[model samples]
Target: MANRTRTPNEGLARLLKQAKWSRSQFALVINRMGAEAGLGLRYDQSAVSHWVGGTVPNPPVRRLIVEAFSRKLHRTVTHAEAGLPLAAFDQAPPGVDTVEGIVDLGRADMDPSRRGVMAAAGLFSAGLAVPVFSAPAHATEASPVTPGKQTVRIGAGQVEAVRRMTDKIADILDELGGAHARPMAAAFLVNTVVPWLRAEASDTVKKDMWATAADLVYLTGWMAMYERDHGTAQDYYVKALKLAGRAEDHVTYCRTLRGMSLQASNLGYGPLALKLADSAAEAAPKAGPRLQAFLMGQQAHANSMVGDHRRARSLLAETEAALMKADNRRESIGGYNQSAYAFHVSHVLHEGKDLPGSISALQQALKVMPSNERQGRVHFYAVLAQRQLEYGHLEAACESWARFLEDYEHISSARGDEHFDTMRLRLKPFRKAQAVRQLSPRIADVALLKA
Candidate 1:
């Protein structure tokens, strides 16, 4: 018998070299990431050697490997880059019904065993497609319940319950942060909302129920996004879109799309954000003034991100005009106020490279923000401090950071934690400054508590 030669995976080998991690070290890091994703993987150096020696990993396993490298290198590493097989998520497939998908996604979000993989490794796709608003009724309708499936009969009161619960969750989110509110939302979906969806009801009542559920789910997804759980957030957003579409609830549908746009913009997907934002606006051509302001503000941010300064400025002007025309009825789900409007103005100015103007706008946002919105204040303070530092205003930055720490101590949030870490790093090089000295002891105390 003749001897055969095996081709090595040059791409993986190249990445391993760039990473400067020994095979064993690489295996350990990947194992830790897998545990976070709920995949109790136990690969050692030998397993890694095999992959580098041209052995292909399964798709899920491949993504795990890619995520590990992406985290290590602080950049995205695709399947092809690692010489692995392509995954189905590259082109998302659609098949599940509205109610069934909601139940499945909500259950996964609620359980640690399932959510470990889902939330910890939440996927953010730059290639996702938004559902068209004008799809035929038959195309977007919920599938008929199978015979023998246990179901209940629901009414308008049940729909109102869902709506009220959603508002309460939003309040908790603003006060205590998503860490405290998301689980409540997940429980509500699985226990209360799912039953209502499966229940028998008049057509009008059913539509109302679906629209209400969609609002709650959209809110849940928004909280996930705030927590930096992108994959879980994306899943919830998609389900909300379907639920809204099935009910022909154009307002909820547009609101959901606007939420998606905000997520995209935050993650630096400028074009996708713009596309989703435009879709949101176009879908509801006759939207009320507040909704118009809500959608246009995001569109302006996306435009600024994409370097359309002229268009972004134009959009900002229109957003202000529409906001002025809107009545005092603050929408619970898709609310837009002067604070939110000013926040968008700050975003546009910052993205347009007008730092001084942006800082001024941010100050206005903070000034008008509701006193009860402490969680939002935590985020705003951190940003203001960082930007103040950037603009060489050391004392002002320290004052802003002091405010951040005050609210930060009371909140339980992954993002707030991240901001705390960043605050420490930013202050490290300025230890000799008087402002920095005054802030150090409090910083140490907070660090101990957070630890």
Candidate 2:
């Protein structure tokens, strides 16, 4: 336990207040759990207070505490459920000034200890504060929508039009995956979709239009990130979130936050990823089952990166439960939403080094995902190869990598290239193997790599 760090749960008091669980009630819950576990440990209000007042319980008790509340609330809770699980606090949530939030999230991912601290807190303190944008700004006079494009204003007809456009954009992007779809999506959004959104329109129309614009912007941002344009992509996500807020589209807002979370996690910001995921979950507590499940699943993904298997598993269970209970009112953001859940779970399992579990989850994900969704398919195959690598199946990893490269080639995406290259580096140990060497040439030929 040399690397064992202590964290205090700050949100414990808040959860207690929300659930109306007094000190005695909390003690009762803990004592009941202890008795159930055959600990024979007597507990009471004072004991609970002492534990809550900065004393760390053994790991068993800690897990039990989380489970106890999860059962009581009929929802998943983390160690942060009790209070801040650790001693440190993260910087306040990002302001809407620019891509600052995205950068902050990136910083958090690179520091595992910070990740632990933020996950321990688990409160959407950011949502409670004033939003970074008070009044939406107009386009600057010199800044055309895009090079020669005219400035667009927000309106009703434009909103409806943008919605239709976004649907088409998403479809095209899905087909292209991370490769060809990246620039196509960005061109469409920048030259057409976003301009339509910023153009003149009534409040009602503007809101509707902004919703569509937000979705498209998010898609573009994700595509850009995949294409390896992180700077531009971060700006797009921030802008998308701002637009989502203007439209009062909580579901999309939450989803964009999750997207930011994914980016953070990918870049190694575990704490920021968890925080952003938490923000999404909090944004729409009543956002029906599907949306909630999606948010929880993303949080689970962030948890897995830090080797927090227990919490990750618990969240996945809750996510599955929520998804199962999701009603017919599915406000899915895109066609990939359903399959994305399974894909993400598989990803978490893969990262956790659980090959069998990863394979099982990936199968489920692939079952729902169409072969045409190149980026998603590439990811699925790439992860499978990672699992193969774990099992000393270099040949299998090579095949998967080859297929991944094939799908990856169909898209204009930088992120896809990064993933492909990262896997290549990991498989370098097998370079002497003819199979790996044979695949290396093809991977090297991918256009993004050439660029």
Lowest lDDT sum, 10 consecutive residues, model 1, at 89-98
Backbone clashes for every candidate come to 2, 40
TM accuracy, model 1: 0.77
- TM-scores of all candidate predictions against the true structure: 0.77, 0.61
lDDT (tens digit, per residue) of candidate 2 on 1-451: 5854434445666676667899898888777777776676677888767675666666556656655665667543444446534222122111222222222333333333353453444322222222332244332311111111223455556656666666665666666654455445554554455335434555566566656767877876676556545555566677777767666677777888888787777777788788888777777647767777878998899888877888988998888888888765423253325577787788788778778888777768767776557667877788778777787778877887887877777765445656776886797777788997788778667844557
Query: What overall lDDT, based on C-alpha atoms, would model 1 receive against the true structure?
Result: 0.82
Q: Put down candidate 1 lDDT per residue, 1-451, tens digits, no spaces.
A: 7755667888888888888988999889778777766778898999999999988876556756765675567544545567765555333222224454565566666754464577655588878776666453542234333223324688899989999999999888888888888888988997788767766788788778888988999999998888888887888898888878877789988999999999999899999999999889888858889999999999999999999999999999999999999999856689999999998999999998899998999899999998888898999999999989999999999999999999989887878988999999999999999999999999999999989
Once fitted onto the true fold, the runs of candidate 2 whose alpha carbons sit more than 4 angstroms away are 1-156, 193-200, 326-338, 423-434, 437-451
Best by lDDT: 1
Q: What are the lDDT figures for the candidates, one per model?
A: 0.82, 0.63
Q: Which ten residues in a row have the lowest lDDT in candidate 2?
A: 141-150
